[model samples]
Target: MLRAGDTLVIWRLDRLGRSLKDLIAWVGWLKERKIGLRSLHEAMDTTTPAGKLTFHVFGALAEFERARIRDRTQDGLAAVRARSRKGGRRPVLNVDKHALAVKLYNEREMPIVKICRTMELSKPTLYSYVRAANGVTDGPPAT
Candidate 1:
């Protein structure tokens, strides 16, 4: 819990806020609570008007940098997609394994736990396979 005179010290001003708006809101909140914010790297102390102004300027620049990085990432992804290439982790189970899991789940003869253990899949993964096969059930098909 934070008290009225508590101080928040951070390595850098940029680390304190996700965005400019968030930084402003946080500073306002701390001010209202009579708390001080100090950033070692920036040598900023929010207890003073000059420090608060400096922090806001730094926060805005940080957010601008983040926006640029996001834009660049999106552009790179778009370029990759244009080449008919896909990104992200491949599915753990291939088509045959997925089909077998779905079949076992639809059969409803084996307990869900046993099926998961036999297939080396988690409950959620097994259920997802069943779902992809359109085997909609209110709950697990078997014991």
Candidate 2:
């Protein structure tokens, strides 16, 4: 139960909920009951007008920080792509191994599982090579 004198403490605004709607509802409910809400990390206390303004300012700052982070990450990825540097996981099967696997599978009608076992590869790796040989641009077919 909540009352006017009680204080609701949270580590951070994000820790309270995943969505804006949920956060707004919770904050509104506390405000209606004249209860104070405090965030330790953000130093936001929703009791005085200044505290309320602080909370809103923090929310805006958090949103700005998130956007900046995402922008930086995308820029980093683009730079890597431009340099032709590998971004994600390196394929286990190189060009030679892929050609060999495709040839063995197509000409001999070798079972996929057996081929994977023989090549000491997982099913996904075998599929990736076969897909690459077929001129599929998208990284490996789904296993």
lDDT of each: 0.83, 0.76
Model 1, range 22-141, lDDT digits (tens) per residue? Answer: 778788888888999998988889998899898988888889988898899889888989999975667868899889888988899999999899989899988877876894644211
lDDT of 2 by residue, 17-71 (tens): 4444445667787877788899999888888888888877776666566668778
| True-structure RMSD for candidate 2 | 13.0
**Which lDDT value does model 1 have at 96?**
94
* Candidate 1, residue 48: lDDT: 89
Model 1 residue runs over 4 Å out of place are 88-143
Clashes of 2: 0
Residue pairs whose backbone atoms clash in candidate 1: none
What's model 1's TM-score? 0.58
What does the lDDT read for residue 109 in candidate 2? 83
Best by TM-score: 1
Alpha-carbon shift of residue 12 in model 1 (angstroms): 2.3
